[model samples]
Target: MNKAEIIVALDVPNAEAMEAKLQEMPDFIEWYKVGLEIFCAEGPAVLEPLKRRNKKIFLDLKLHDIPRTVGNAVKTAAAHGVNLMTVHAIGGRAMLEEAAKAAAKCENPPKLVAVTTLTSLSQEDFVDLGISRTVSEQAVELGRLCMASGIDGMVTSAHEAKALREAFPDALLVVPGIRMPEGDVGDQKRVASPSFAVEQGATHLVIGRPILQAEDPSAAATAMLNDMNK
Candidate 1:
């Protein structure tokens, strides 16, 4: 079985808050996801501390733009020495292809993954947006497009991990919206337990609030890793 990795989400407001969370986490916590909130607040300067500590980064900006613009952005992110980054699969084939090419050209490229669907949305949400397909169908469709466009992985809800795994066995399926069985779901609509996601072949599990909001963040992260291993 593949060893599932845990990426603690640093969803803080500023660099100070991010640094505090980092201090609370255990050494075994190898990867940290620097999402929109903190990244936008602190910019690339925030990542320097993580690099100094030798921790891996998952830069989840979910880049969505025109081909040339997205490609340039990828080059810039790669220069920051991130281990992984995300783009929107909904951006279509040409944009994904360009992002892939940009990464390939970089000397120390970040592995690119595409976001399928946000876990916050439901079928009703899709209908409101005039998206005709169901959530599962949309994830698969976009995932297929990503592979063909040469992107390496996908950021999807754990609910869709099994289907994506069966469809693309070797593809990196990074699952977010993971909550412990006794934990609150918060804003996520399709959350699942860590064990369930790992069983479904999720390679990396992105957990934010459960660990970040715990009374003891390190204990919370350790418990989450235990759940994944179980």
Candidate 2:
């Protein structure tokens, strides 16, 4: 059977821990997300094996910096053979445009995906950060800015997926912070089921923990794929 359009997060402490989970992953699970923790721990060298095995990579460093700095970072990420890399849309249009331009120069440029509001935040959380915009309004605004800046993909909460998809019809909305129905939410304040996101027009799903922490990782992944198929 075709696997679900899911990207499993390899959020372990180090390359060794990620390697252990790699062996347990179902064959149909071809894409992997190497986020800030593991990437910082092991560096791009850690993803070399995944590339050798031909697995697609989503390098989620959530780059947020000045235009020149973010641009330089994108060049390096693309050179590492990542299929997707993230920048924060909150960094504004100039930086987004610069990162896009940098990626355009790579021999095998990774798709530039800008991050909207993180899913771990709530309305209360926004107020704490001194922002008045509701989470949904902020996400949509950032997504619009990213699109207007020429980035085609965005990393956003599944809670915002339907509205984001509506606002940016052609975007590759990579919804993170996914949770199974009635599953433990961990630190994510905004979450959604895989089926609900699919129904709402999310182009991809970035799921961590739920599958990785399951007793039988392969079975958990397979079950998630089955769930997505429904």
Candidate 3:
């Protein structure tokens, strides 16, 4: 078994809603992704509850900015004691390098991963933005840049996980937009099942709707874990 971890995304509107969702989840779920909605609503204080639970936090801010600003944000996240965090790979080499250096200075640095392309985007969307490369190409190209710039890993679709793993065998490949075979795709355009993501070499699987919105969130999470660990 690959032992790929399941990271439940807390996609709720506020800290209260997020706490309710966490209460619904099983204790076996060791990781949680604290994204923009809840983080922005509650600020750094939003992480306190999860810290009390001793759960690992994946802060999915997808930070994008100039070198100095992003570096400062990285330092702040490190201070918050996140286990993992994301920056936009499109932010380019200088920003990525600065983010890496900031992490290196932390006593307990969070593993910094770069976002290659969002799972909600289609290839046509890239074309609309005047980019000629396919989603996979762009992901791999950015993955290379991330490694060269000292980023620890990347957030990519499972569609590109295999290529990324092959190119950078040691890089942490975090795959989001995970949906069960029978589950609704919702807003994500490039989605995969838990088993598919694990088999493709994803180190962490980020699932939101399927598990969080299920009638029995704990059972749903256990089932997804079974699928990934199979």
Candidate 4:
């Protein structure tokens, strides 16, 4: 329930799948993230159960749209009592600002986080996307923009966590792309162990497959928490 175990990414298919994992929820992992897949399949209905359990929620919709649209979207998300939410920094400063402002208006505003370059993207991927800068460079630039726009945090790879912490010491760094030492990489290109991520100054680590796909998810989650404590 401490800051170190602040968030856990639930990248499963739907509420049913997520509920299966919820049975394995450890006391240490208090926060849960509802990403695109789960959101698209279950909508706000899925959130009710988590809310009843009094678990903090992070709605990872990764909203990317024009300023006005994104602002309205954030307002709706905030009303749902989510503790955190994400927007794509690629949506630009105007969109980021609008999202932040919308959340701020909520009686219990969710922390607005901007997603920089995705963990699945490599330097070559950036080149293929016609971006001249390296992924790290793009991440830093996007992070800076998000901070200026009053965002509460950023979702970045652990590879950039150190540099990002240096630039924004007080800002929360919610890192995905986390892998245990023996874990498979899956679709993520940039990854780090949970202990390494915490050592690198990440405020939160978003782990999915390693815990969710394990033979015993609660035990797996406990092991991850133990690793972070080390």
Candidate 5:
């Protein structure tokens, strides 16, 4: 069986803490996720060091905007040479297609992924947004939009992974709402263990907290990868 690819989320606020956390990461960690927090705070310059080490970057800015505008933003991000980037499927097919087209122009385009539904939300949260479908239903709809847009992959919670994998068996299914057994889940409402996600056909696992907050970040990451490869 193919072990799920492991990518740690660099959710820290600034470059200093990011470097510290990275130092604690095991050498086996070749893929890293740079989310909005650090990207907004430090800009693309923050990614230079990781690129120097040849680490694959998942620039999770979750771009959601008008089609032309999001396409421009995606072009800029692609210029940064990131390995993966996210655009929200909620932005609609026009926006997603624009982003994909922009990436295709790059000599080394980042894999354009669609952000389906955020894992932090619950069913009650969807009602607040006037969304009639359940989170799973919404994810399925957005995932199909991603497929129609010619996007390369998707970002969804593991709870919805099986459904997505069934729909797009060849697409990169990256799940982020992961909490190891007995770990604090914090704001994420739809979460699962790394093993369950992998078993459900998640291609990559974007894990944070449990690994980054541990006293031994490298060891924590190794353990998680161990679980992924088991």
Candidate 6:
């Protein structure tokens, strides 16, 4: 159960749904992510069962706010014993720095990851929002700012992983928007196979629907692990 094998995105609607998935999860997968949906639905209580199972938890709340607020939020997340968490680089340097500082003080700090442009967003989407740069460009710039603020890692698409690895060799690149060869891309505009993501230097892969929607989730997760190792 190496950290890189798989990170199941617990994107279910509530704790009950997550528990149902957990019952079917394979032992090979050692990590699980609690995203906004579940976190908002079940709150911190959702994490208790996963912890009881000895699974490393990644709280993906994607916190974004003013400096003081975000900082306090990071501290609170750390107290919950989550292994990883995310903030928005778009939240600006002050907030990022504040979060970083808060994480640093935690006795066992959760890895602070920053969200760049989401995989669901395309260059056209950015254009529609009056952001003139391409999606890749914006992601890279945001990655830089996150690094400068001293955060542990970032959440980006596999499409940008190689370039980002080159630019920030020491920073962890936790990627989402992963699709298996036979999997559907769904709403994600930027995606890569598990093997491709690993070869490109991604430290972690966040997978949701492909595993969750599979007829056999544990087997699907195992297959994804095999693909990543290949």
Q: Global CA lDDT of candidate 1, please?
A: 0.94
List model 2 lDDT by residue over 83-172, tens digit each.
998999999989999998999889998898888888888999888899998888898888889988989778888778778889987888
Worst 10 residues of 1 by lDDT: 1-10
* Pairs with steric clashes in candidate 2: none
lDDT of each candidate versus the true structure: 0.94, 0.87, 0.94, 0.87, 0.89, 0.89
Clashing residue pairs in candidate 5 (N, C-alpha, C atoms within 3 angstroms)? none
Which candidate do you rate higher for lDDT, 4 or 6?
Answer: 6
Q: Residues 86-168, candidate 4: write the lDDT tens digits.
A: 99999998999999999888889889888998898999888899999977788789989999999987888888888888888
The TM-score obtained by model 3 is 0.98
Candidate 5 per-residue lDDT, tens place, 1-230, comes to 35678899999999999999888888888899999899999999999989988999999999999999988988888788899998888999888889999889888888988888888888999999999998889988889989989998799898888999898888889899888888899888888888999988898999999999998888888888777767
| Pairs of residues clashing in candidate 4 | none
Candidate 6 weakest lDDT stretch, 10 residues: 1-10
In angstroms, how far off is 14's CA in candidate 2? 1.0
Error of 5 at 120 (Å): 0.5
Per-candidate total of colliding backbone pairs: 0, 0, 0, 0, 0, 0
Model 4 accuracy (lDDT, Cα):
0.87
65-163 in candidate 3: lDDT tens per residue?
999999999999999999899999999999999999999999898899999999989999998989999999999999999999999999999999999
Model 6 Cα shift for residue 31 (angstroms): 1.0
Give the per-residue Cα lDDT of candidate 5 at 221: 87
Write one digit per residue (lDDT tens) for candidate 1, span 1-230: 36889999999999999899999999999999999998989999999989999999999999999999999999999899999999999999999999999999999988999999999999999989999998999999999999999999899999999999999998999999999999999999999999999998899999999999999999999999889888
Clash-forming residue pairs, model 6: none
Question: What lDDT tens digits, residue by residue, belong to model 6 across residues 77-122?
Answer: 8888899999998999999999999999999988899999888898
